[model samples]
Target: MTSGSEFPFSPDPVLSGTSDDRQHALQLNPQQLLDRIPVTIWQANDQGQIISLSARWQLITGRAPVDSLGEEFWNSVLLEDRDLSLQQWINACQQQRPFVLHLHLCSIRGNSCPFLIQSEPLLNDTDQLIGWVGTLQSTDVVIPLQSKWDYTQKFLQALLDNLSNGIVACDTQGVLTLFNSSAKKLHGLPLCPIPADEWASYYHLYQADGTTPLPQAEIPLYRALQGESVHNAEIVVKPSQGKPRTILASGDPIIAQDGQKLGAVVAIQDITLRKQAELELRKSEERWQLALQGTGDGLFDWNIVTNEVFMSPQLKQTLGYADHEVDNNFEGWRQLVHPDDLGEVAAAIEAHLRQSMPLYVAEYRMRCKDGSYKWNLARGQTKWDDNGQPIRMIGSHQDITRRKQAEMELARLNRDLEARVTSRTTQLEVAKNQKEALVVKEQEARRQSEVDRAGIKLYESIISNIQLGILVWHSQNLESVDHLELVSTNPAAESILKMNLHVEIGRQMSDIFPSFVGKHPDILLSLVEIIRTQQPRSIENVPYTFPEGDENLFSLRAFPLPEDCVGVAFENVTCKETNEPAFS
Candidate 1:
């Protein structure tokens, strides 16, 4: 009972009138069965104080039942859950109905465990309320639920019963903990507890030959702990309690989510009878030859110590050879092996003999009886002595000409693909150069347009700045006079000369200048003199007549430029004439 609990049990359900009050008594041995029960059972007096508890309380709660008597049991409850458990208990009692809640039990060792607390009120024969019966079952309610772990445990148990192989498991500390029935039978007895390092000694396991002591590093269980899956590894176990047994063991590592090595599981199978049958079968050469025939393979056995080799009849038959046609020496094989495959095949065998490889396996060509070659895949396993030296070797050959031919075809296609890529790349380069040439042509044309624009601007500036009339003339003849031709003239030249030759830029000098019906010959004479002498000539007060019959006084001059071209400058200086003398 809680020391300060306030609620009372309701009397309605506690009476013997309802099905809730139905009760029956059965005989139970408290000392024999109750203590062994996996849950904690308790009884509380009518006053709601705990009177008794099962022994499991001590194991799970880490406390003696006596230490949790009466309301002190509420002290064992965690402080946060005590009041709620008390209230739940009182309410269930008052209502006379069973109640279930979860409680955290604090152990004497300062650890806590969760429990499913259930309670039902007990009554007397007089229909009077009695003490309460309650149970505390350890629960996961207070901690995170491990649904996956529970599933794994159930799955592992299921597999143990169904699998044929004897399985043994160990905890992380290397202590053997689980031994399935199969394991017990295969091992002849349960393995006594031993350190992980002493397993080989305690178990007495040997190599497949039954005499060589099995190395700890070669043990399946130890290799599993190192995170490997060892399969079909044969060994012999000669136990002190049983006859010698040969077994095949496979093992795997049980690792955690964080890659922690949790444990190892090893499966053992008894192969003693099977191994004996295999040995008996090996004695009949006819059966061996028949087996090789069924598999369509040829066999060869080599004795390294004696330098002797035995080739099966099927081997000679495969090469289209009759019995006794080929030599019985290893040199026969070397001569038949294709030259291209000789070095590689030799290297493969040497690598296995030197222990660099686990098995000797190679695909190569061997010359046939018809002088053609056939591809064959050869595989062998060696029997080694204690010092890892090969004593005997046995192998088989399988025809693989189709596979090798397919590989050659694939290589041919790869070469064709490379050729196509190279051709495509060259074509792209040629197109790229053509596009670059077009770009160069476009740039040159744009530069020419810029130069033309600059020349036009310069010409306009010189014409607008010069004040005197300027006429450009070129000689039309080389050895004659009066052959002056007008090539160009400015607006000043046309206006001052009163020629009004706005639309006559390329007219000849004879058409633009006043010639007075061929009487004004001085103008032509001056041009001829300038061209012949390549010098300047000036004429003052020159008489000039217009085509309208009006006379004008003008000062005229002609200057020679290079390339038989002349420039003329003339002005109407009638008002400014001061009788300056002119010379030509």
Candidate 2:
């Protein structure tokens, strides 16, 4: 089944063409001839183990021939095509026939290029398989005759499809002639037959702002078709199905040799990631600027090695100087500081840089342009070189004049308060002694008042609990019985009288005790005498009978009271001996 003319050439050398050709051709060695050829020739034993490869293999694939020898050549084939290609080669070897394949070959540069491979098995005189030989030619190579145009077109299409950048082309009439694979993927759609006016909308094209639609004339391909060369114009593509992407376009008008306009082509690169990074960096810088402004602090950077200083505009404005008025150097800044604070400021900086202190901080009074001094807080950190020598320092300066003034005023007030307190000490002592004496007098008066109240309460208690029946009688003039009324009585009086006197409190005493008028008419006379003379009188065992039809004898005593009233006390004397004289 072996073919006669496909690879494994049998006797094709030429020596009869011309004297120069014969000499040159004869001088060429086998390796030299192989290297000069456009195609790579390779050989494998009957078992498909690669045995040899020509140097042209390295030139085209960026791989060494030695690395591809033996079975390792199969590893260089792309994974997607290796299995099919190897199976076809195996079938050809078993049938002892010629083989052909169009497959992709992977290069060390990480690109896959299409190639045409053809092989034929070498047989012994007895038709036993010995080895196989093949020729590898890139698909882009031009074949000799009729199929050349067709192959060229296929080769160009393949090349365009493999590119990472999107490509678009249009004819002179503004009709799109080519939209490569990458272009379709980037725009999320394929070619449309619309006119140039609708190209932007059809392809989802936008301006660099990503919101405004791109004008038809401003489209890169459209401008290029109008004979304009567009370079690095940023465009946005918002696909309906995915996230928007940013692309940079460059294109030129295609002009013929005779200056005739043929067409236009544009190449676009996706720059979405780069643009996003730049946007984030810009926002971060804006935030940093806002922070510096919010804190009202100015920036400073000093090059310790070069003795150069840089101060921010805010710092210069705080000092009442124009941007260029102040010299930017350590000595210039030192002159602005108060003469007394320069030593401590320099010491702080030295300690941080030389002694490896964590921070450099100094508070001092600085003189402004108007010859006024203001307090300032300066803080910084140092950057060191590989040898640990301080090379630079960067920091901020804040105005603390108001805070420093407040502190000084508070200190002065505290001193004045101490002196005033010392002066008032004698007066306070005299007032304390006087107040103590007054407190002692008040305490004695309060104790005496408490004793008087206790004695009054005791006397009333004795009066209320006395067993003698006592009654208080009141009169307006002691003139008539209708004019006097019984006022009050005690519990003991009610018990002795054998009646509830509380209910009879408002009755006239004559109505209460009829004995005053009838039983012993002397009792009435004695009562009248007692009322006229405010003297107390007593009666002894005067047999008194009466109003409830019982006879009883009781000793009675009457005492005149203030308020035209009299208090009468009586005892039940019915059990006493009547023969003895009751009064002594």
Mind giving the per-residue lDDT tens digits that candidate 1 earns over 1-584? 21223223321222234454333112223242455556777777787777777778877767777778887788888887676566556545665656676667887578776678888888778868787877787676334575665688789878896778888877555556567778777777774545467778878889989999899899888888777899989999998887899999899999889987667989999988888866884755433442342234677888787767777777778888775887776887788899988999999999999989999999999888898888887889998988988988888776666556655655554565566665677665555564455455545544543454454345445445655677767887846655666766778887877776556666666676535427766567667778889778787777677667777787777777555777777777767646664323
Question: In candidate 1, which residue ranges exceed 4 Å CA deviation?
Answer: 1-155, 191-193, 286-584
Clashing residue pairs in candidate 2 are none
TM-score of 2: 0.33
Clashing pairs in 1: 1-48, 1-49, 8-94, 9-93, 9-94, 10-94
Q: Across residues 82-124, which tens digit of lDDT does each residue of candidate 2 receive?
A: 7656655554466566766667799757888778888888888
lDDT of 2: 0.75
Model 2 regions more than 4 Å off: 1-151, 300-313, 318-320, 323-584
Task: State each model's CA lDDT, in order.
Answer: 0.71, 0.75
What are the models' TM-scores? 0.29, 0.33
Model 2: residue 210 alpha-carbon error in angstroms:
2.5
Top lDDT hit: 2
Candidate 2 lDDT for residue 58: 85
